[model samples]
Target: DLAAAPGVGVDRPRSPQPLVTAAPRADLVIWAPPDVAAALRPRAEDFGRTRGVSVTVESVSDVRSALQDVTAPESGPDVFLGPHTWLGEMEQQRVISRVTLSRNQQRRLAPKALAGARYDGQLWGVPYAIANLALVRNTDLAPQAPQTYEQLIANGRRLKAEGKVNRILLQSTGSTGDVYSGYPYLRAYGGGIFAKTPNGQYSPGRLVLDSPASLEGARRLAELGREGVIQPDVDNTNAVPLFGDRHGAYLVTGAWSVPVIQASGVPYAISPLPALPRGGKPVPLLDVDLFYVSATAQSPKLAQEFVRDCATRRDVQVRLARATGLPPALTAAYRDVAARDHHYAAWFDAGRDGDPVPSVPAMQAVWGPLGQAFADIVAGKDPQHSLTAAARQISSDLP
Candidate 1:
């Protein structure tokens, strides 16, 4: 994971010595995913060589382990790369250092993306990428993506009558994926997950899970699932794969699936989530991941410099775009040649107008009840009862 830190110096003498040393030592260390590490290592080496700094590359297995090592006194990294949500927990624990962005640098980022990095009035991380849900449709099967919730249902019924498909794809693997994909529908129907009070506490918003609009939405979704419009195995293990395999005509997915979709050679088009039943716009849930500095690091200055380099540097942003297929967090990088040619550009455009997922600490409470509520409703439980029960649970769980 040390290799994942942006602007890690590699040019110092005995660079290879660190790798062979009994105990590895380096000017900087980073934590990130394997694929991101693989893509970043060579470039980082190049940057290090140019600057004459010796850097060591170490790969940590997962986010949790990486965070643990980075927070440990002896093994901590100078920089950590992961989701911005980590900031909420890390900041609350006083494990991360605050980063102050220049006005211009902040201006270059999407507003919602920037908001995700801000926790407790300080920006904790530099965002590398931003993603959100998009409606993907097989143009061959359905010439046009639905423009509204009603239209989507109508199209589903027509296609089912003709025996073209079985289910519309909505991810429900866990609380996170379910909320990301399902909240748009709930919001479109004029429901919200939480309400913020003047004192900064979050209250349970109107539990509209069983409202006419939510019921209408869930019923449509359940109808699709029941009529065989969706695959029977869509419980959790393989809903995404079902869509990737072309078992369904429509899916709500993020840009992360670009590689799989391309490899599958499936002909598809992207559109924003359909509008809600009352004609309100559908607001896709946007997820932003950010880079953060560890407070215990040897050099907070160096860590902040590295984050700034990662956040604003064109080369780093371009490589990030190439590696992840996610839109670069910076406006200037969005115009890079690589991003321009990617077929997912329309989805990124759609995401520009979407809503950021709630980032407050209290936001965590919304996950469990919402997931169970949706699952229960889909399993044929009474919608109003299911939603009311979930809301009560959520209210009790909120901080």
Candidate 2:
């Protein structure tokens, strides 16, 4: 008998189980950050072993390389794990197979996670971990968390003047962190990178970063940096050390930093990114990692079965939760040990209202110009001019 029951059918008697059972075996390939792989591999192996499947794990440093290997003749693994934003491009290239979720399964996921995995009206992946940016503040320095961007700026200035902190720790480096930290300001001012139609398709051509709201937000960000409230170095690596040392009062970071922060022995608290002027909420960017089956797999059926097993198994979800400080993509797993633990409880609360990052292929166009604009702003260029130029460049790059 197969160790796990099939998902589609009702429970039945075991008396008439198949006399001859096929050996359950699958290859799980992951293209993730090195730290993530180190944390998640053991749990994945244990989950596979419990189901009587032979599991093999391989790690790739980059998703592009993983995609190349999977699409190569005779080299593809049965399953792939990586960021959900890749779903849009992978679907367009027909390199991934879609997975259908039942109503129960759908309801179990955070709505933003569910929405992030859908591309062109089909669900292409199962979420493993969900991430969002938040305000990480040094408790010693910030007795009270600021509730608005204006307040953050005001408080940041006072902290800097008092020599209580080196800077506000915003990242303007050409990294994912830069985009995550910068986009919220634009959203707080009622601007967005892409607009979605009522039918759910995103129109990237309608880039609105040059709008008055976006320019104003950008100007505010630049002003904060210019006043020496924000650190001179926007490199993510540089900011981490400063934050860990409590040299900065607040830094924008994601759930991924939970373990790091705890290990650093700093007294800290996590809170929602401050709201914008006129009462709009700050929109934190969410990035989700997903599990997918390669379309070119030799045993597509078995591969999908493995995908289903990983997605619906409560035990697997719990193990994943404990292994990584990340919240499980499953709702039931939200109450598990890791989620309830002190280090992560605040992250779960902050993520409850987070926004999903745009998953359109055109999202790629925003990265280059956005990074340049942030760099220019930090270097003392006029925020309005830099943002306007970046928005025009993004519009020109849209497909």
In order, what lDDT does every prediction score? 0.63, 0.66
Q: Which 10-residue span in candidate 1 carries the lowest summed lDDT?
A: 6-15
Q: Write the per-residue lDDT of candidate 1 for residues 1-399, one digit (tens) a residue.
A: 122221111110111211121155577666556556656666666655776665444554455444654435557776766766555657777778888789989998867788778765678888878878787777777688788756766776677668776665545433222555556666665565654457433344544455666656655555544654433345434555666676667777777765666777778888887775446666676667677788887656766877776546777777777777777787777778334675547767778676566655555666667766666655556767767787778767766
The root-mean-square deviation over C-alpha atoms between each candidate and the true structure, in angstroms, is 6.9, 9.5
Best-fitting candidate, measured by lDDT?
2
Candidate 2 residue lDDT tens string, 198-222:
9755666677787887776777667
Distance (Å) between predicted and true CA of 55, model 1?
3.2
TM-score of each: 0.82, 0.83
Residues forming the 10-long window of minimal summed lDDT in candidate 2: 5-14
Clashes of each: 17, 0
Full-model lDDT, candidate 2: 0.66
